[model samples]
Target: MRRFAPLALSAAALITTLVQAAPAVAAGSVPGGGHPAGGHRTEVLELVARQTQTTFIDHGDPGTSQGDELVLAGDLLRGPALFGRFGEVCTLTRVGPEPDSFDQQCVGTLTLPGGDLTLQGLVSVTAAGPGEVTVAITGGTGRYRTAHGVIEAVNTSETETRLTLRIIL
Candidate 1:
């Protein structure tokens, strides 16, 4: 069991590295297409988030669960500001008859006070365990830019729950 701990820790570290590195590929562009009206774009200067009630457990049996809320407020280059406050309730269940295995599910809502932005999403445990989870956004409208495409500022929301993504971008 002790030997497995080192392996598990290594695997978890690798997963975290991969997730953090993926976002550096492209930091510009919207999802759908086109730039903001009049070519005015808002650049995300900094993001500060405070998450409470977030819980984590090692495995099944005697595991613990908790509920918390999060508040994230950030600044944009333009006059628009971004802020999101959401409550999260999640459970981590040890994966059946298997050691070092667990699953987690989190459902929450994100809201932006300055702009027409809102998000209703669920993040679930995946791959290795609770450390790795997939996020699915259901309904919301906001502006996001990436190298792949430009998501215009519109009332667009996920209808069919799109694809299972490992990152919450």
Candidate 2:
């Protein structure tokens, strides 16, 4: 232990120096919280969704086979205020029985005031309808140009879906 003291001290000093040189990454501020430059932060967005339109496109065998697509569009709300809109395209990737037996590849977008956030992932389809999915934020446009994160989407009803976003730049 005696011989290891100086080496341990040097290692601790190096670690301290590295931590001091690293950038500060506190959780991001809210929308009005002034977007700081080059900060690794998380911006949270909570919105209620009202699905306005949906369509099914049959491919190949004209049934619920692979490549069948479901397209959905909706309005987004914060409380009673309608602030944005969203659209999603889901393609059947696997077909099986009900509940957890089916999966669909989904790509979606959130059209907000300043920009749009895109997402892609697999959504599990049940006999009732499309369930919930956590998707990767594939990039964005305008103010969200540098955006990349995850979105949690739940289909609360046939006409409603809820969304929560963790956006990082």
Candidate 2 Cα misplacement greater than 4 A, ranges: 1-38, 97-100, 126-131
Per-residue lDDT of 30-103 in model 2, one digit per residue for the tens?
Answer: 54334466456678776665666666787887556778776777776776678788777777688775533466
lDDT of 1 at 125: 31
TM-scores for the candidates:
0.37, 0.72
What's the CA error at residue 134 for candidate 2, in Å?
Answer: 0.5
Model 1 sits at a Cα RMSD from the real structure of 11.7
Per-candidate count of clashing residue pairs (backbone under 3 Å): 12, 0
Model 1 scores a TM of 0.37
Evaluate residue 122 in candidate 1 and report its C-alpha lDDT on the 0 to 100 scale.
Answer: 31
lDDT of each: 0.26, 0.58
What TM-score does candidate 2 get on C-alpha atoms?
0.72
